[model samples]
Target: MTRSTWRTRIGFILAAVGSAVGIGNIWRFPWLTAENGGAAFLTVYLLLVVGVGVPGLIGEFVIGRRSNRNPVGAFDELAGRWFRPLGAVALLASTVILSFYSVVGGWILRYTAASTTGAYFTAPQEYFAAIDYGLGAVGFHVLFLAMTVAIVYLGVERGIEVSTTVMVPGIVLLFGALAVWASTLPGAGGGYDFYLSLDVAYLRENLFSVLPAAAGQALFTLSVGAGTMLTYSSYLGEDRSLAADGTLIAVLNTAIGVLAGLVIFPLLFSLGVSPGQGGPGALFVSLAGAFAELPYSRLVGVVFFGVVLLAALSSAISILEVLVAYLVDEHGLSRERATLGTGGLFLVTGSIAALSPAVFALLADTLANVVLTAGLLGFLLFDGWVLGRLAREEYARGAGPIARLFELPWYYAIAVVLPVFLAFTLVTGVGGILGIGISTRGAAAVAVLGVGGAILALRRHGVPG
Candidate 1:
């Protein structure tokens, strides 16, 4: 019997991009910018997306195609037993990610139904506030989880690939229409100015303030740190170039993210709905208000929510696939058993997030950022320290000349510098969680020492790729 492979390069690209360009782009990005410094925030975000995000994405691909297994199996195959914990960490991170991911997907599903029923037309803010925090959200989350489980149980090629093929087109079409409509809204020009207009002085003054947020956005937007990409890449057969494919996937995902902002901000500006008061609820509260008041908005509301639902499902499918692949390949479980087992556990985890808004807030906010950064650091250490020469060889398998040259410098940065930065962010993040402002300089030193310690250990007794 033959092993399963991605149906086509186009399908793989679309599925991968679809996973990246989801709730974070539509539900998170605009608000993060507005919270920090608006246009200046946007400027910083673009820089990180290009400078760090793209290259990091390629690094994940290099791991995946080289190992051709789940994150746990991939690490176990590529490195010695001393590094098994890193693979476990990746699996744990993915599981943690999917928990909150499903909660947000529930929001999209609830909104989709609300759009049809005109639930928000009567009292947009109150409706959103009520449903977003309590039992209503829990129910919708279960619905979303069930849908995701159904697909994963169906197997990857037919379930994930096929649904993503349909969903991606719908997301594009709805966003295009929403952007067009936003331009005609009376006060939308202000939103565009607020979101798009550059503030060079502000950026220069608060560059440090925005760096972590921008970096977080870049990581989340590409879905890089969670091993979703690693899992996807593991199935590759090396028929195509990983570097080129990674670049294209990153570009398309970033483009859609920018487009989501274009559509969302303009509508908020036009409607006189401030994007901040609602926090994460801004997407729902603001859009609901617009639909309730604007001319012919009921029809538009249906289209917009439908679009969001499609995008949410595409991402949810990818999250489930990570675990589904693990169960079948690692444990020799049937696809059905894996899907049900993981999905049931997520229901409990996601319900905790839904019922306890504060927990949900932590999961969606600072805690999530910290976890992802740490997970990425783990992957980098595995690749650059534990798997250095071997990773370079895997990267070279189908890469071109320019990419080939980047192999060494990329190694130095990942092995040495990237981990330091990741550790510093983790400390700052822990500080934020605890409410402190101790010396960032000290944090930087700790980052360097931490990475150095790990590298020395790797050399002495850790896994060999």
Candidate 2:
């Protein structure tokens, strides 16, 4: 039996965008901005999106489209046996990500239900604190993971393509509508200024602190370097241009991220909910509070959490796909077995995160960044070093003359600059996570030289993808 592919280009792009634009954008984006100097973080994030995210997006596609295999096989097929370790690492990273991601998805689903039931009417934050702990969140996490397993086990055509096509448009429409509605609220202007204004001094002082975050968001938001992109691209039929598809996905994801900020900040500001202080609960508690105090409040709560549920589900599907593909490819497990096995693992791991705020905070912040950045470093190395020649050729295939011109720059960036940047980010992000933010200068020194050492090691091996 042949692997199923997307029936249309629109389906492909929408599915990619669906995975890219999710809880990461809504819940995480606003929070990260609040943590890392609001507007300053946004500026650097935008810069990295174009620089790091887009190329990494193309690189994943090249590997996937070229081999027409799942992520593990794709690298092994092109970059030889040595590259398989990196492929395995990407596979593991996705599984780790999904374990936590699905729990968050569950939180969204519960909030959506609560919104409909008017649960946020009295003490929104307190309500969140009560429900978002221990057995409650664990139960919800299991349910969310089960839903993800069911859809992904159905395979790409019915599972990913159809689901994303429907949900992606719905999410976009809902957020846009929410933004318009939020704009009418009293304090919406303050929210807009806070979110969109440029802060040059803040940017200069905290560029390094924010760099890893923006890069991680770019990577996480795009679902790039996670092997999900590679898995999705593996189904490509070559009738579509890889460059064009990647660009559309990146643009849509970025647009949605900005759109989410527009919707969230306005609502929170309008309610006098200091977005800076809200943490992960802010999007839920803050917005729920806003709805409670506003006219026709119940309707807005339904709309907001409904949008989040859709976004969360879409992204969860991508996360589930990673483990599913890896199991089916590497271990020769059936889709059903793989999803079950993966879900079973997450059941325990996610419970830990659910029960402990410390762990969840770590996963959501520094730890997630470290793992993802490290994984991307491994991925870019596999592409640039191990799969170097084949990546160039694959990137050129079905590419327009205009996009083809970017091949060398893409190569150098992924091959040289990105790995160093990733290394710096890995250390710096870890440092901050460990309460060592003041040591960024020392971290920067290591990031510079260590990444170079990685490139030299690759050169010594003469890896050729």
Query: TM-score of every model?
Result: 0.94, 0.95
Judged by whole-model lDDT over C-alpha atoms, candidate 2 comes out at: 0.81
lDDT of 2 at 263: 82
lDDT at position 265, candidate 2 = 86
Q: List the pairs of residues colliding in candidate 1.
A: none
Question: lDDT of model 1 at residue 142?
Answer: 96
42 Cα displacement, candidate 2 (Å): 0.8
Model 2 clashing residue pairs (backbone):
386-464, 386-465, 387-465, 388-465
CA lDDT of each prediction against the hidden true structure: 0.80, 0.81
lDDT of 1 by residue, 239-265 (tens): 677878888988888888888888778
Error of 1 at 117 (Å): 2.8
- Report clashes for each candidate as comma-separated counts: 0, 4
Off by over 4 Å in 1: 1-3, 200-209, 293-296, 462-465
Cα miss at 370, model 1 (Å)? 1.0
